[model samples]
Target: MPSFHHGAVEIAYLDEGEGEPIILIHGFASSKNVNWVYPGWMAELTKNGRRAIALDLRGHGDSGKLYDPAEYGIGTMAGDITALMDHLNIRRADMMGYSLGARITGWLAYRQPERLRSAIFGGLGIGLIKGGGPGENVATALDAPSLDDVTDPVGRTFRAFADQTRSDRKPLAACLRGSRELMTEQQAAAIRVPALIAVGSKDEIAGSADQLGKVIPGSQVLHIPNRDHMRAVGDKVYKTGVLEFLLRRP
Candidate 1:
């Protein structure tokens, strides 16, 4: 795991294989390994002759953590991705993000479209517009003394994940506090880059993939069969659909 400084913060990342580059951003409480590597995403992309780059978003995995909610703004997090790209001298690359990562990617697509060749929004959907996912309860849950103290169903799940990942919950709580900005319909409609919205069919967290698709002009949607938010990341249909979309994109 190599790392570089994006200002005061150290962003840790994995760069694997070679060809066109694709950056993978994990969901909240998930590291690059947990989100992409262990799920066989690295193998699928690398074997397909693509350079797979994954990063530990600040406050998660090996990346530097900051406790101030102000430091974890959605744009601030997105800037970390651009900084990483600049560090590698990548003019533009395909970008894939899940859940929170998807929100960050969507921000980039709207504000910095030149930096992305294409965008993949996974484990996210119309919630990008509707503006509701983990909220104060999740943040409060992260700060709870123990997982047993987290009573909200979603909060408990995320707290458990944080514990499993051995993550420091304080910074995560701040991150959840800061990175909650939602996209406007105008912003989504303005995205011109080739885009794919992939969501699990059973994902209640991601709103509606079709609705998001309708908002983003010319974007494609893929529904992973019979899976939920957690199980959809590594689904074969998702990998295949993304690969096919990549191949077909100009």
Candidate 2:
């Protein structure tokens, strides 16, 4: 339940265990508890003598919410992570990010590679353009409700999304908006630290494992067979691949 003021927004996060620090960044629409803690990742990391820190990105979970589109940019979110590390006096740490969080972690790795010991990215990929980057697309999406008040195809899709948003729509929407500026293949190639790329075998959003493996240099991509985005992170295959990759000395 501990919180830190990262710039103008307050970020809520869980800080537990003690050893080499590992920061866990959850996907869009999910909190630390729902995404990482519920899966027992905290205990798993702690059992291995590694500190686990799961952060509820700004505008998600118990963190402060900002409706301003500019405030939700990817740069701002990445800055929040840097600020958190600074506040904790952590000079360097391993990082793991999923979905929107993954995109942000990529940016952090590109911008501040020196501060990272290693990184794990899941549920997202480079060159995947969906919602428009930054303000325009996000502002538009945030204005639209999950339900469109019609029974058409679009409405049905909205209804399904609404069900997922029931837990926390505002932050989820903000994360979607923020990720519009994710890096491209050229940018991702600039990363020098050890990296891990993983996705569920059935994750259409992240594309095929072969594609992810091709882009990152010396990076290992693990495909959790028969699993999709949500299931991949919790699966034994996914956790084992991630833990092993993180603990390996480069």
Collision count for each candidate, in order? 0, 0
Q: Over the stretch 9-41, how does candidate 1's per-residue lDDT look in tens digits?
A: 999999999999999999988999999999999
Compose the digit string of candidate 2's lDDT tens values, residues 1-250. Answer: 7998976788998899999999999876677887789888898899888999989888777888876557878888888898988888999999998877787888888889988888788876543333222233333444456455434543344235435646455555555554577567777777877888888877755655556557667778777789866577788888888888876847
Would you estimate the TM-scores of all the predictions?
0.99, 0.87
Candidate 1 residue 51 C-alpha distance from true site, Å: 0.5
lDDT per prediction?
0.95, 0.74
Q: Against the hidden true structure, what lDDT does model 1 obtain?
A: 0.95
- The count of residue-pair clashes in candidate 2 stands at 0
Show where candidate 2 strays beyond 4 Å: 126-165
Winning model by lDDT? 1
